[model samples]
Target: MKVNYDAQNDVLKISLSSTPVRNCDFDKPGVVLGYGSDGSLVDLEIREASRKIDNPRSVDLAMNGRSVHGVRLL
Candidate 1:
Protein backbone atom coordinates (compact mmCIF):
# COMPACT_ATOMS: atom_id res chain seq x y z
CA MET A 1 0.00 0.00 0.00
CA LYS A 2 1.05 3.56 -0.57
CA VAL A 3 -0.10 6.99 0.48
CA ASN A 4 0.55 10.24 -1.22
CA TYR A 5 -0.45 13.84 -0.75
CA ASP A 6 -0.21 16.44 -3.46
CA ALA A 7 -0.13 19.77 -1.70
CA GLN A 8 -0.36 21.65 -4.96
CA ASN A 9 -3.56 19.89 -5.88
CA ASP A 10 -4.88 19.58 -2.34
CA VAL A 11 -5.49 15.92 -2.94
CA LEU A 12 -4.79 12.99 -0.70
CA LYS A 13 -4.55 9.51 -2.14
CA ILE A 14 -4.42 6.20 -0.35
CA SER A 15 -3.59 3.33 -2.61
CA LEU A 16 -4.18 -0.19 -1.36
CA SER A 17 -3.40 -2.11 -4.50
CA SER A 18 -0.83 -1.86 -7.24
CA THR A 19 -3.28 -2.93 -9.88
CA PRO A 20 -3.88 -0.51 -12.70
CA VAL A 21 -6.93 1.66 -12.24
CA ARG A 22 -9.47 0.95 -14.93
CA ASN A 23 -12.34 3.00 -13.61
CA CYS A 24 -13.14 5.64 -11.05
CA ASP A 25 -16.30 6.94 -9.50
CA PHE A 26 -17.01 9.73 -7.14
CA ASP A 27 -18.42 8.33 -3.94
CA LYS A 28 -19.35 11.81 -2.88
CA PRO A 29 -18.74 15.37 -3.90
CA GLY A 30 -15.01 15.28 -3.42
CA VAL A 31 -14.34 11.66 -2.77
CA VAL A 32 -13.37 9.31 -5.57
CA LEU A 33 -13.03 5.55 -5.50
CA GLY A 34 -10.72 3.81 -7.91
CA TYR A 35 -11.33 0.35 -9.18
CA GLY A 36 -9.13 -2.15 -10.91
CA SER A 37 -9.97 -4.12 -14.05
CA ASP A 38 -11.07 -6.97 -11.80
CA GLY A 39 -13.61 -4.62 -10.20
CA SER A 40 -11.77 -4.59 -6.90
CA LEU A 41 -11.15 -1.40 -5.08
CA VAL A 42 -7.71 -0.07 -5.87
CA ASP A 43 -7.44 3.27 -4.17
CA LEU A 44 -9.20 6.31 -2.73
CA GLU A 45 -8.73 9.95 -3.37
CA ILE A 46 -9.94 12.94 -1.47
CA ARG A 47 -10.07 16.29 -3.15
CA GLU A 48 -9.80 19.54 -1.30
CA ALA A 49 -8.38 17.72 1.66
CA SER A 50 -7.85 20.88 3.64
CA ARG A 51 -11.52 21.70 3.61
CA LYS A 52 -12.71 18.15 4.17
CA ILE A 53 -10.17 17.17 6.80
CA ASP A 54 -9.31 18.91 10.03
CA ASN A 55 -5.60 18.69 9.40
CA PRO A 56 -4.87 17.84 5.84
CA ARG A 57 -1.13 18.19 6.32
CA SER A 58 -0.94 15.67 9.09
CA VAL A 59 -1.57 11.97 8.72
CA ASP A 60 -1.59 9.25 11.35
CA LEU A 61 -2.03 5.69 10.18
CA ALA A 62 -1.75 2.33 11.82
CA MET A 63 -1.67 -1.19 10.46
CA ASN A 64 -2.07 -4.45 12.37
CA GLY A 65 -2.59 -2.45 15.58
CA ARG A 66 0.90 -1.01 15.39
CA SER A 67 2.65 2.09 14.12
CA VAL A 68 5.85 2.59 12.21
CA HIS A 69 7.57 4.45 15.03
CA GLY A 70 6.50 1.94 17.70
CA VAL A 71 4.42 4.64 19.34
CA ARG A 72 0.73 5.35 19.67
CA LEU A 73 -1.21 4.90 16.43
CA LEU A 74 -4.46 6.38 15.43
Candidate 2:
Protein backbone atom coordinates (compact mmCIF):
# COMPACT_ATOMS: atom_id res chain seq x y z
CA MET A 1 0.00 0.00 0.00
CA LYS A 2 1.08 3.56 -0.67
CA VAL A 3 -0.18 7.02 0.12
CA ASN A 4 0.68 10.19 -1.74
CA TYR A 5 -0.35 13.76 -1.32
CA ASP A 6 -0.13 16.57 -3.85
CA ALA A 7 0.05 19.74 -1.84
CA GLN A 8 -0.43 22.02 -4.82
CA ASN A 9 -3.64 20.31 -5.84
CA ASP A 10 -4.72 19.54 -2.30
CA VAL A 11 -5.29 15.95 -3.37
CA LEU A 12 -4.53 12.78 -1.46
CA LYS A 13 -4.25 9.37 -3.10
CA ILE A 14 -4.14 6.07 -1.30
CA SER A 15 -3.33 2.90 -3.20
CA LEU A 16 -4.70 -0.20 -1.54
CA SER A 17 -3.18 -2.69 -3.90
CA SER A 18 -0.80 -3.10 -6.82
CA THR A 19 -3.63 -3.97 -9.20
CA PRO A 20 -4.00 -1.80 -12.27
CA VAL A 21 -7.10 0.37 -12.23
CA ARG A 22 -9.54 -0.32 -15.03
CA ASN A 23 -12.10 2.28 -14.14
CA CYS A 24 -12.66 5.14 -11.76
CA ASP A 25 -15.81 6.37 -10.08
CA PHE A 26 -16.65 9.68 -8.52
CA ASP A 27 -17.74 8.64 -5.08
CA LYS A 28 -18.67 12.21 -4.29
CA PRO A 29 -17.84 15.76 -5.26
CA GLY A 30 -14.33 15.55 -3.87
CA VAL A 31 -13.77 11.83 -3.64
CA VAL A 32 -12.95 9.17 -6.22
CA LEU A 33 -12.71 5.41 -6.08
CA GLY A 34 -10.58 3.32 -8.38
CA TYR A 35 -11.43 -0.22 -9.32
CA GLY A 36 -9.49 -3.04 -10.86
CA SER A 37 -10.63 -5.07 -13.85
CA ASP A 38 -12.39 -7.48 -11.55
CA GLY A 39 -14.27 -4.57 -9.99
CA SER A 40 -12.46 -4.77 -6.68
CA LEU A 41 -11.48 -1.49 -5.05
CA VAL A 42 -7.87 -0.65 -5.73
CA ASP A 43 -7.37 2.91 -4.67
CA LEU A 44 -8.98 6.09 -3.41
CA GLU A 45 -8.46 9.75 -4.12
CA ILE A 46 -9.62 12.70 -2.13
CA ARG A 47 -9.65 16.22 -3.47
CA GLU A 48 -9.53 19.27 -1.24
CA ALA A 49 -7.87 17.03 1.26
CA SER A 50 -6.59 19.86 3.37
CA ARG A 51 -10.09 21.02 4.12
CA LYS A 52 -11.41 17.50 4.55
CA ILE A 53 -8.77 16.23 6.95
CA ASP A 54 -7.45 17.73 10.15
CA ASN A 55 -3.85 17.63 8.96
CA PRO A 56 -3.66 16.62 5.30
CA ARG A 57 0.11 16.52 5.27
CA SER A 58 0.40 13.80 7.85
CA VAL A 59 -0.17 10.05 7.54
CA ASP A 60 -0.84 7.34 10.08
CA LEU A 61 -0.69 3.66 9.20
CA ALA A 62 -1.92 0.60 11.05
CA MET A 63 -1.64 -3.09 10.26
CA ASN A 64 -2.24 -6.22 12.32
CA GLY A 65 -2.68 -4.11 15.46
CA ARG A 66 0.63 -2.31 14.95
CA SER A 67 0.54 1.37 14.23
CA VAL A 68 2.98 3.86 12.76
CA HIS A 69 2.79 7.63 12.92
CA GLY A 70 4.26 10.51 10.97
CA VAL A 71 4.77 8.47 7.82
CA ARG A 72 5.86 10.17 4.59
CA LEU A 73 7.13 9.08 1.21
CA LEU A 74 10.10 11.47 1.42
Candidate 3:
Protein backbone atom coordinates (compact mmCIF):
# COMPACT_ATOMS: atom_id res chain seq x y z
CA MET A 1 0.00 0.00 0.00
CA LYS A 2 1.12 3.52 -0.74
CA VAL A 3 -0.14 6.97 0.07
CA ASN A 4 1.17 10.07 -1.61
CA TYR A 5 0.31 13.69 -1.86
CA ASP A 6 1.27 15.86 -4.81
CA ALA A 7 1.29 19.46 -3.72
CA GLN A 8 1.50 20.80 -7.25
CA ASN A 9 -1.49 18.80 -8.34
CA ASP A 10 -3.34 19.02 -5.04
CA VAL A 11 -3.99 15.33 -5.33
CA LEU A 12 -3.86 12.63 -2.66
CA LYS A 13 -3.30 9.21 -4.09
CA ILE A 14 -3.62 5.94 -2.19
CA SER A 15 -2.40 2.95 -4.08
CA LEU A 16 -3.40 -0.44 -2.71
CA SER A 17 -1.98 -2.65 -5.35
CA SER A 18 0.41 -2.65 -8.27
CA THR A 19 -2.04 -4.49 -10.46
CA PRO A 20 -2.95 -2.64 -13.63
CA VAL A 21 -6.13 -0.63 -13.48
CA ARG A 22 -8.70 -1.72 -15.98
CA ASN A 23 -11.26 1.01 -15.38
CA CYS A 24 -11.90 4.16 -13.44
CA ASP A 25 -14.94 5.58 -11.70
CA PHE A 26 -15.67 9.15 -10.79
CA ASP A 27 -18.82 8.51 -8.79
CA LYS A 28 -18.30 11.38 -6.44
CA PRO A 29 -17.03 14.91 -6.65
CA GLY A 30 -13.27 15.26 -6.40
CA VAL A 31 -12.84 11.52 -6.09
CA VAL A 32 -11.58 8.90 -8.48
CA LEU A 33 -11.48 5.16 -7.97
CA GLY A 34 -9.43 2.63 -9.86
CA TYR A 35 -10.45 -0.97 -10.31
CA GLY A 36 -8.53 -3.88 -11.66
CA SER A 37 -9.75 -6.16 -14.39
CA ASP A 38 -11.10 -8.60 -11.83
CA GLY A 39 -13.22 -5.89 -10.22
CA SER A 40 -11.01 -5.35 -7.22
CA LEU A 41 -10.07 -1.88 -6.08
CA VAL A 42 -6.53 -0.95 -6.96
CA ASP A 43 -6.20 2.67 -6.03
CA LEU A 44 -7.97 5.88 -5.11
CA GLU A 45 -7.31 9.53 -5.83
CA ILE A 46 -8.70 12.55 -4.11
CA ARG A 47 -8.48 15.89 -5.89
CA GLU A 48 -8.25 19.24 -4.14
CA ALA A 49 -6.86 17.22 -1.30
CA SER A 50 -5.61 20.16 0.71
CA ARG A 51 -8.98 21.82 0.70
CA LYS A 52 -10.85 18.71 1.69
CA ILE A 53 -8.43 17.15 4.13
CA ASP A 54 -6.89 18.62 7.27
CA ASN A 55 -3.46 17.23 6.49
CA PRO A 56 -2.62 15.65 3.17
CA ARG A 57 0.92 14.55 3.91
CA SER A 58 0.77 12.35 6.96
CA VAL A 59 -0.69 8.99 7.90
CA ASP A 60 -1.32 7.03 11.08
CA LEU A 61 -2.34 3.43 10.88
CA ALA A 62 -4.49 1.63 13.40
CA MET A 63 -6.21 -1.72 13.55
CA ASN A 64 -8.78 -3.10 15.94
CA GLY A 65 -8.15 -0.94 19.06
CA ARG A 66 -4.43 -0.80 18.71
CA SER A 67 -2.05 1.40 16.82
CA VAL A 68 -0.11 -0.52 14.25
CA HIS A 69 2.22 2.36 13.54
CA GLY A 70 2.86 5.79 14.87
CA VAL A 71 2.24 8.99 12.96
CA ARG A 72 4.22 8.82 9.77
CA LEU A 73 5.74 12.05 8.55
CA LEU A 74 5.64 11.91 4.83
Candidate 4:
Protein backbone atom coordinates (compact mmCIF):
# COMPACT_ATOMS: atom_id res chain seq x y z
CA MET A 1 0.00 0.00 0.00
CA LYS A 2 1.05 3.54 -0.76
CA VAL A 3 -0.35 6.95 0.03
CA ASN A 4 0.46 10.17 -1.76
CA TYR A 5 -0.82 13.69 -1.46
CA ASP A 6 -0.55 16.39 -4.06
CA ALA A 7 -0.55 19.63 -2.12
CA GLN A 8 -0.74 21.65 -5.30
CA ASN A 9 -4.05 20.01 -6.20
CA ASP A 10 -5.18 19.22 -2.67
CA VAL A 11 -5.66 15.64 -3.78
CA LEU A 12 -4.85 12.45 -1.94
CA LYS A 13 -4.36 9.05 -3.52
CA ILE A 14 -4.15 5.74 -1.77
CA SER A 15 -2.99 2.80 -3.83
CA LEU A 16 -4.07 -0.54 -2.45
CA SER A 17 -2.74 -2.67 -5.26
CA SER A 18 -0.75 -2.55 -8.47
CA THR A 19 -3.54 -4.13 -10.49
CA PRO A 20 -4.66 -2.40 -13.63
CA VAL A 21 -7.80 -0.37 -13.13
CA ARG A 22 -10.64 -1.42 -15.40
CA ASN A 23 -13.15 1.14 -14.31
CA CYS A 24 -13.62 4.05 -11.97
CA ASP A 25 -16.65 5.20 -10.03
CA PHE A 26 -17.41 8.25 -7.97
CA ASP A 27 -18.55 6.88 -4.66
CA LYS A 28 -19.47 10.41 -3.60
CA PRO A 29 -18.59 13.99 -4.34
CA GLY A 30 -14.84 14.52 -4.38
CA VAL A 31 -14.18 10.82 -3.86
CA VAL A 32 -13.40 8.16 -6.48
CA LEU A 33 -12.98 4.43 -6.34
CA GLY A 34 -10.98 2.41 -8.84
CA TYR A 35 -11.67 -1.24 -9.51
CA GLY A 36 -9.77 -3.95 -11.23
CA SER A 37 -11.12 -6.12 -14.04
CA ASP A 38 -12.08 -8.71 -11.43
CA GLY A 39 -14.12 -6.10 -9.60
CA SER A 40 -11.72 -5.86 -6.70
CA LEU A 41 -10.86 -2.46 -5.28
CA VAL A 42 -7.64 -1.12 -6.68
CA ASP A 43 -7.26 2.36 -5.26
CA LEU A 44 -8.96 5.43 -3.89
CA GLU A 45 -8.72 9.10 -4.75
CA ILE A 46 -9.89 12.02 -2.69
CA ARG A 47 -10.19 15.51 -4.07
CA GLU A 48 -10.21 18.52 -1.80
CA ALA A 49 -8.26 16.43 0.66
CA SER A 50 -7.11 19.37 2.69
CA ARG A 51 -10.67 20.20 3.61
CA LYS A 52 -11.54 16.60 4.39
CA ILE A 53 -8.57 15.67 6.57
CA ASP A 54 -7.13 17.42 9.54
CA ASN A 55 -3.68 17.34 8.04
CA PRO A 56 -3.43 16.19 4.47
CA ARG A 57 0.38 15.99 4.48
CA SER A 58 0.71 13.82 7.56
CA VAL A 59 -0.45 10.29 8.38
CA ASP A 60 -0.39 7.93 11.30
CA LEU A 61 -0.33 4.18 10.70
CA ALA A 62 -1.14 1.36 13.06
CA MET A 63 -1.19 -2.43 12.88
CA ASN A 64 -2.29 -5.18 15.29
CA GLY A 65 -3.46 -2.57 17.78
CA ARG A 66 -0.05 -1.01 18.09
CA SER A 67 1.49 2.19 16.78
CA VAL A 68 3.97 0.46 14.55
CA HIS A 69 5.13 3.49 12.64
CA GLY A 70 5.71 7.13 13.21
CA VAL A 71 3.77 9.86 11.47
CA ARG A 72 4.81 10.51 7.91
CA LEU A 73 4.73 13.95 6.38
CA LEU A 74 4.41 13.94 2.63
Candidate 5:
Protein backbone atom coordinates (compact mmCIF):
# COMPACT_ATOMS: atom_id res chain seq x y z
CA MET A 1 0.00 0.00 0.00
CA LYS A 2 1.11 3.54 -0.73
CA VAL A 3 -0.17 7.05 -0.20
CA ASN A 4 0.86 10.30 -1.84
CA TYR A 5 -0.34 13.84 -1.40
CA ASP A 6 0.33 16.60 -3.86
CA ALA A 7 -0.04 19.91 -2.13
CA GLN A 8 0.42 21.84 -5.33
CA ASN A 9 -2.53 20.20 -7.07
CA ASP A 10 -4.19 19.28 -3.81
CA VAL A 11 -4.43 15.74 -5.05
CA LEU A 12 -4.18 12.58 -3.03
CA LYS A 13 -3.35 9.22 -4.58
CA ILE A 14 -3.85 5.95 -2.80
CA SER A 15 -2.93 2.51 -4.03
CA LEU A 16 -2.58 -1.10 -2.98
CA SER A 17 0.27 -3.13 -4.46
CA SER A 18 0.88 -6.11 -2.24
CA THR A 19 -2.67 -7.35 -2.57
CA PRO A 20 -5.11 -7.38 -5.43
CA VAL A 21 -8.25 -5.28 -5.05
CA ARG A 22 -11.58 -6.98 -5.35
CA ASN A 23 -15.18 -5.83 -5.27
CA CYS A 24 -14.06 -2.29 -5.96
CA ASP A 25 -15.48 -0.09 -8.62
CA PHE A 26 -12.86 2.33 -9.85
CA ASP A 27 -13.78 5.09 -12.26
CA LYS A 28 -10.48 6.48 -13.50
CA PRO A 29 -9.89 7.70 -9.91
CA GLY A 30 -11.03 10.90 -8.22
CA VAL A 31 -10.99 12.91 -4.98
CA VAL A 32 -12.75 12.96 -1.60
CA LEU A 33 -13.78 15.89 0.57
CA GLY A 34 -13.71 16.70 4.28
CA TYR A 35 -14.38 19.82 6.39
CA GLY A 36 -12.11 20.96 9.20
CA SER A 37 -11.39 23.87 11.52
CA ASP A 38 -8.94 25.62 9.18
CA GLY A 39 -11.02 24.86 6.14
CA SER A 40 -11.84 21.93 3.90
CA LEU A 41 -10.92 20.36 0.62
CA VAL A 42 -13.79 20.07 -1.82
CA ASP A 43 -11.84 17.50 -3.77
CA LEU A 44 -10.81 13.97 -3.08
CA GLU A 45 -8.90 11.91 -0.53
CA ILE A 46 -7.40 8.66 -1.73
CA ARG A 47 -7.15 7.29 1.75
CA GLU A 48 -4.46 4.62 1.39
CA ALA A 49 -4.12 3.41 4.94
CA SER A 50 -6.85 0.79 4.52
CA ARG A 51 -6.30 -2.89 4.04
CA LYS A 52 -7.66 -6.38 4.62
CA ILE A 53 -5.86 -9.15 6.42
CA ASP A 54 -6.36 -12.92 6.57
CA ASN A 55 -9.44 -12.54 4.38
CA PRO A 56 -11.34 -9.95 2.40
CA ARG A 57 -14.02 -9.69 5.04
CA SER A 58 -11.96 -7.79 7.61
CA VAL A 59 -10.12 -4.54 7.09
CA ASP A 60 -7.92 -2.06 8.91
CA LEU A 61 -8.29 1.60 8.16
CA ALA A 62 -6.89 4.98 9.07
CA MET A 63 -8.09 8.22 7.66
CA ASN A 64 -9.31 11.72 8.37
CA GLY A 65 -9.05 12.29 12.15
CA ARG A 66 -9.18 8.80 13.49
CA SER A 67 -7.73 5.29 13.58
CA VAL A 68 -9.75 2.05 13.32
CA HIS A 69 -8.93 -1.30 14.87
CA GLY A 70 -10.04 -4.91 14.50
CA VAL A 71 -12.64 -4.47 11.82
CA ARG A 72 -14.69 -7.62 11.72
CA LEU A 73 -15.70 -9.70 8.74
CA LEU A 74 -18.98 -8.70 7.22
Candidate 6:
Protein backbone atom coordinates (compact mmCIF):
# COMPACT_ATOMS: atom_id res chain seq x y z
CA MET A 1 0.00 0.00 0.00
CA LYS A 2 1.09 3.52 -0.81
CA VAL A 3 -0.31 6.98 -0.22
CA ASN A 4 0.25 10.18 -2.15
CA TYR A 5 -1.10 13.69 -2.06
CA ASP A 6 -1.22 16.20 -4.91
CA ALA A 7 -1.56 19.65 -3.43
CA GLN A 8 -1.89 21.26 -6.83
CA ASN A 9 -4.95 19.19 -7.68
CA ASP A 10 -6.15 18.94 -4.08
CA VAL A 11 -6.25 15.20 -4.53
CA LEU A 12 -5.20 12.64 -1.96
CA LYS A 13 -4.78 9.16 -3.35
CA ILE A 14 -4.48 5.90 -1.46
CA SER A 15 -3.65 2.83 -3.46
CA LEU A 16 -3.27 -0.85 -2.68
CA SER A 17 -1.21 -2.80 -5.17
CA SER A 18 -1.79 -6.20 -3.62
CA THR A 19 -5.52 -5.60 -3.19
CA PRO A 20 -6.08 -3.73 -6.47
CA VAL A 21 -8.49 -0.87 -7.12
CA ARG A 22 -11.36 -1.00 -9.55
CA ASN A 23 -12.94 2.35 -8.69
CA CYS A 24 -13.01 5.31 -6.34
CA ASP A 25 -16.03 6.73 -4.58
CA PHE A 26 -16.50 9.68 -2.33
CA ASP A 27 -18.08 8.79 1.00
CA LYS A 28 -18.91 12.19 2.43
CA PRO A 29 -18.91 15.13 0.03
CA GLY A 30 -15.27 14.58 -0.91
CA VAL A 31 -13.95 14.71 2.62
CA VAL A 32 -13.64 10.93 2.89
CA LEU A 33 -13.43 8.53 0.02
CA GLY A 34 -13.32 4.82 -0.61
CA TYR A 35 -11.12 2.93 -3.01
CA GLY A 36 -12.77 -0.23 -4.14
CA SER A 37 -11.86 -3.35 -6.03
CA ASP A 38 -14.76 -5.69 -6.70
CA GLY A 39 -17.00 -3.72 -4.31
CA SER A 40 -14.59 -4.08 -1.40
CA LEU A 41 -12.48 -1.21 -0.12
CA VAL A 42 -8.82 -1.76 -0.85
CA ASP A 43 -7.85 1.70 0.34
CA LEU A 44 -9.18 4.95 1.77
CA GLU A 45 -8.38 8.63 1.28
CA ILE A 46 -8.98 11.89 3.08
CA ARG A 47 -9.55 15.03 1.08
CA GLU A 48 -8.93 18.51 2.41
CA ALA A 49 -6.84 16.70 4.96
CA SER A 50 -5.30 19.77 6.47
CA ARG A 51 -8.69 21.16 7.38
CA LYS A 52 -10.35 18.07 8.84
CA ILE A 53 -7.45 16.03 10.13
CA ASP A 54 -4.98 17.70 12.44
CA ASN A 55 -2.72 14.62 12.44
CA PRO A 56 -2.54 11.04 11.21
CA ARG A 57 -4.65 9.85 14.12
CA SER A 58 -7.60 11.93 12.92
CA VAL A 59 -7.39 10.18 9.61
CA ASP A 60 -7.71 6.78 11.19
CA LEU A 61 -10.54 8.00 13.36
CA ALA A 62 -12.48 9.31 10.40
CA MET A 63 -11.98 6.22 8.26
CA ASN A 64 -12.82 3.74 10.99
CA GLY A 65 -15.60 5.91 12.41
CA ARG A 66 -13.90 5.82 15.79
CA SER A 67 -11.46 7.69 17.92
CA VAL A 68 -8.20 6.08 16.93
CA HIS A 69 -5.49 8.18 18.47
CA GLY A 70 -2.47 6.96 16.50
CA VAL A 71 -0.56 4.34 14.62
CA ARG A 72 2.78 3.09 15.82
CA LEU A 73 5.57 1.77 13.63
CA LEU A 74 8.33 -0.44 14.88
Query: Each candidate's TM vs. the true structure?
Result: 0.80, 0.85, 0.85, 0.89, 0.28, 0.46
Candidate 4 overall Cα lDDT vs. reference? 0.90
- lDDT for model 3, please: 0.89
Q: Model 6: how far is 64 from its true place, Å? A: 20
Write model 3 residue lDDT over 1-74, tens digit each, in one string: 98888988999999999999999999899999999999999999999999998888777787788775546545
Give me the runs in candidate 6 sitting further than 4 Å from their true place: 18-20, 32-37, 55-74
Worst 10 residues of 6 by lDDT: 53-62
For candidate 4, lDDT tens digit of each residue in 1-74? 98999999999999999999999998599999999999999999999999999888888888888774447655
- Which has the better TM-score: candidate 4, or candidate 6? 4
Per residue, candidate 5 scores C-alpha lDDT tens digits across 6-48 of: 4445444444343333333345444344333334322335433
lDDT of each: 0.83, 0.90, 0.89, 0.90, 0.43, 0.57
lDDT tens per residue, model 6, 1-74: 66666555555666655575677666577555455556876767766755655543223433556665455311
lDDT-wise, the better of 2 and 5 is: 2
Worst 10 residues of 4 by lDDT: 65-74
List per-candidate RMSD values in Å: 4.0, 1.5, 2.0, 1.5, 14.6, 6.0
Q: For candidate 5, what is the lDDT? A: 0.43
The TM-score measured for candidate 3 stands at 0.85
Clashing pairs in 2: none
Question: By lDDT, is 5 or 6 better?
Answer: 6
